[model samples]
Target: MDIEDTPVLDNHMHLDPIEGQNIDAVEDFESVGGTHLLVLNKPSWHLFDPASDEATFEEVFELTIEAAADASEVLPGRAWPVLGVHPGLISQLVDEGYTAAQARDIMQAGLDVAAEYVADGPALAIKSGRPHYDVSEDVWEASNAVMRHAFDLASEVGCAVQLHTEGSEDLTEITEWAQDEGLPPEQVVKHYSGGRLAGPIKSVIAEKDELEIAAELDEPFLMETDFIDDPDRPGAVLGPKTVPRRVRWMLEEGWEDAVRRAHVETPARVYGIDTEATLGR
Candidate 1:
C-alpha cells in the first residue's frame, strides 16, 4: 500500500532555508500527499560549532523559525511545529567547557533571547503560558539534570519532542536521561533513525531499546527521517524516500495498528487535534 496516501503527519522536517535553497521546493512534499507537516528546528549545534562547516546557529534558527512561521500561517491547519534541541547541543556545551558558572551564563543567555523573541516564540506565546524551547546545562552535569529539564519542557508544551540519536552508543545515555526527566518512551521521537550506525546492527539495537521504552511508558514511539532529500544537501541522512519506506516497514512488520494507535490516535489525543480520522477532512 502507498503509506503516504494514508495521510501521515511527517513528525520531522526542516522547512527553513539557510543556504538560500528554500526547502519549500520539497516542503509541498508531493510524494506523500502529506496531510500536516511538523517542521523541526534547525540543527543549531552542528551549525554553531566551529568544528563544523555548517552555518551559525543564530542564522539557522532565525531563518528556520521565520520560514516555519510563514508556512504555518499560509498552510494554517496543515503545518505544525516540532522545535528541536538535540544531544548535539550537549556536545557543544561540553566542547565549550561548560561548568556550573557556564550553565548560569548559558541559561541567562537563553532567557534573554527568549524574552527578546517571546512574542514569536512558540511555547512562550502559547495560550497555556509555557516556555517555547526546552533547554539545559545538565547533560554536561554528571547527573543528567539538564536533559531532564528539556524533556519536562516538552511535556509542558504538549508537542512531540524531537531528537537525533546516532546509534546504540548514546541509546543508554538517552534512556537514562529520559527516565530521569520522567518522560516515558512514547513521549519522544528519534529522527535520522537510519543513517547513524552500521547495518542492521544499530537499527535493531535502537529499535529494541525503543520498544522496551515504549512498553515501559505504555505509549508508541515516533520515528522520523530528520534529513532532507536534496542531493545538494549532502549532510542530510534520510531524504523523502525513507519516509514511505518507514511506513511500509511499519506495516509489513505488523506495526500498522501501532502506527495508527501511536502516530495518529495518541498524537491527536495529546496534542488536542481531531483525529477521528486523518487530517484530510
Candidate 2:
C-alpha cells in the first residue's frame, strides 16, 4: 500500500511557494507519507493593516480557501484548510491607527469567511492566537482580546482552531474560555507545542523531546514538521518528509498506537477529514 493508503495526516503546514520549483504541494505531500493536510496560507500570519482596502482581508481569506479548493482536485478529502487572521496581523492593524476593537472586527470578518469555507468543506479549522513573549503587556492583552473574539466565532461556527503560540502559560485559561464559549477543549489545537501543556489537542515540533511527550501523553495529540517550505530556509524547522521518517522510527520503538492516534484517528475526529478515504482519490 502507498503511504497515502496508510493515511498519514499532516496536522499543520504552510503552502508557500517553493523557490524555483514547479511543485504541487498536495501531490508532493502524498508522494511521501501525507494524505490529509491542514494548509494555512502563506500570509495567514502577516499583513492585514492596509487601513484602506477591504480587498486586503479578502485576499487573505480567499487565498486560504482557494488553495484547499485547488488541492481537492488532486486529492479530494485530503486538503483541509485552517484559516483565520493571526495575532501579529491584528497588531499590525492596531499599529495602523485602528483601535483594538476595530482590529478585532477585521479578524472576525476573516473568521466569518473562514467559517463559510469550513461549512463548504474546504476549511476544517480557524488559525489564530496571541502575540509572542516579548511584546508589551498591553499588546499582549490586545492580542488576547482579539484571540478571544476569534474563539467566539470559531465556537459559533463549530470548527476546530489552530493556535500559534509560545509556551502554554495560559492553556488552562484558554481551555476554560473554549468550554464556556461552547467550543469543546478538543477543538482547541495549539501549534508548535513542546514542553507545552497539551491543549485538548496540539501540533508539536517533531523533535525527540516533543515526540516523547506526545508518546507519553495521557490523551492523544498531533505531531508536525511545521514545514515552512521556503527555499531560502529549506526545512527551517524540518522538511516535509520528516514526519513520515520520524514516524517510521516511532513505529520501530512500539509507538504504532500513538502514531496512529495522531496521524489518523484524532484528525478525523478534530478536522473531519477522512484520511483513509482520501487515498486513491
Residues 1-281 of candidate 1 have per-residue lDDT tens digits of: 35643545555665536553344534444344444455655545434442222224345446556765665553323555444344444445546777544543443333233223433545221100111234443543422343455455544444434444433334545645554556554444444443232211111112434433332443444444555433467436445334445555656665666556545665554444543353443
lDDT of 2 by residue, 22-99 (tens): 136567665655656677765543333342244665676676566666666665355666877666776677677777
lDDT score for candidate 2 against the true structure: 0.68
Most accurate candidate by TM-score: 2
As a whole number from 0 to 100, the lDDT of residue 110 in candidate 1 is 39
- What TM-score does candidate 2 get on C-alpha atoms? 0.86
Candidate 1 residue pairs that clash = 138-146
Candidate 1 lDDT score relative to the true structure: 0.44
Taking all chains together, each candidate's TM-score versus the true structure is 0.59, 0.86
lDDT per model vs. reference: 0.44, 0.68
